[model samples]
Target: MDADLVECRACPRLVAWREKVAIEKRASFANDRYWGRPVPGFGPADASLLIVGLAPAAHGANRTGRMFTGDRSGDFLYAALHAVGLANQPTATRIDDGLELRGTRITSPVHCAPPANKPTTEERDNCRHWLDTELELLKPTLRSVIVLGGFGWQALLPVLAGAGWMIPRPRPKFGHGAHVRLTGTTTIDLYGCFHVSQQNTFTGRLTPLMLESVLASAGRTAGLLP
Candidate 1:
């Protein structure tokens, strides 16, 4: 699955943009070699808690081949995770940075980096199947999900519904700290958080404590914490 995922070119615009960024290179990271392909989820496959964000950052994951690495947004997120004891380190600059996640995983709704950090609805839907496949594989242990933005929140509900979880009519709204539990043979707790994008963190819309609080809640719910 990992091999097939990295080679996906289902979206032509995304294909061109991710590859173009890899070749042109960010001036500050001119020495860096870019992943320039679909970035996969990171952490143990048996992770009990999942953090879902938007697409990979242009120079961040797209360059490092790992989700949330080499970016300020990741710095904000990992710091929170470390404070809450889910991550061994508060920094992720490279794929092999000695970072580790404990009973948790990070992923994105869209795998490839999109132009201007925005993917069209078509592009988002085009990437949905990969998430579906991932969820199927995660069903045994994925008890909770932390969605990082409205885009990911909107994209995820349908996927969860399609997987046999009963989504309430009119659907749950997105907001920081919003929590919804879906019923199926097994239940899932869905959490909403503001994206850790520079726009949010820089403006203080999402403080480190706020993120840590939610993560702690999810971790306990997933039985990853006391």
Candidate 2:
């Protein structure tokens, strides 16, 4: 499934943009080879906790080929995860940077980096099936999910409902530290956190302590911590 997901080009606009940025190359990453294809979720298959972000960064994951890698957003996220005992290390500069998630996984609704970090509704819908399939495969062991930002929160609710969980009508609102109970064959808890984007982090909107608190709470909820 991962092999097939990597070759996806279903969204023309996303395809063009990801590939274009790859070839042009950022000045800082000119010597680095870009993983311009759809970046797959990273972490163990049986992860009990999942972190869903909006999408890969144009020059970040699109360049390093790993979710949240080579970007300030990733720097903020990994450090928090490490602090909360959910990651082996805090640095995520590259795919081979030796960073490891513990009983947790990171993924995005739209795998490809969208232009200007925004994916059209159509593009977001086009990429739904990948996440749909991923949820089914992870359902057995998955216990909690932390959705970052409104885009990811909006995108994930329906997918969770379709994957056999009961999402209440009017839907759950998205807010930092918001949480909801999702009932299915197995109960799963869903959490909302502000995206660890540079805009949020640098502005003091989402601080290190804020992120670590959420992670630690989610990890304990998922039974990943005592």
Candidate 3:
């Protein structure tokens, strides 16, 4: 599954931007090779907890080929996962960093990194196929989800509905700590969290304790922790 995702070139703009960043390498990582491809969701296929983010970071995941790797955003996320006993380590530096997640998986709505960290609506829609397939495969064990921002929250609604989860007519609004459970052939409880971006963490818009609380709640909801 990951093999196919890495080879995707469906979005011309993303294809160009990702490759450009790989070649123009960030000064700090000038000596390193960049993955410069779509990053697949990371964790066991039967994970009970799924985390969805907006997209890869131009110099972060785009460089390491792993979601949130080599970036401050990953630092904030993995640390919280570790505190909840969902991650083996509080660091996600590279694909082979020896860090691992248990009972939880991390993915993005947009696989490829976008210019200025924003993927246009078309790019997001074009990328939905990957996420749709992923959710279908994870349906059996996926019991809870944590959307990392408004973008992910919005992107996941229709995907969940399409996948057989009944969505509310008015739709739930996105807010930190917001949670709703959908019932259909399968039930999945969704929780919202502020993105672990520097803009949120550094500004105290999202604090360590706050993020941990939501993760802990999801962990309990998924029966990953007591």
- Score every model by TM-score: 0.98, 0.99, 0.99
How many angstroms is residue 154 displaced in model 3 relative to the true structure, after the best TM-score fit? 0.9
Residue pairs with clashing backbones, model 2:
none
Worst 10 residues of 2 by lDDT: 94-103
In model 3, what lDDT does residue 27 have?
96
Q: At residue 219, give the lDDT of candidate 2.
A: 97
Each model's C-alpha lDDT? Answer: 0.93, 0.94, 0.93
- Give the distance in Å from residue 55's predicted Cα in candidate 1 to where it truly belongs: 0.1
RMSD of every prediction: 0.7, 0.7, 0.6
- lDDT by residue (1-226, candidate 3, tens digit) is 7889999999999999999999999999999899999889999999999999999998899999899999999998999899889999999999899998999999999999999989999999999999999999999999999999999999999999989999998999999999999898778899999999999999999999999999999998898999
Q: What is the C-alpha lDDT profile of model 2 across 104-142, one tens digit per residue? A: 999999999999999999999999999999999999999
Could you tell me how far off, in angstroms, the CA of residue 197 lies in candidate 3 after the best superposition?
A: 0.8
* lDDT measured at residue 109 in model 3 versus the true structure, 0 to 100: 95
Mark the regions of model 3 whose C-alpha exceeds 4 Å error after superposition: none
List the candidate 1 regions with Cα displacement exceeding 4 Å.
none
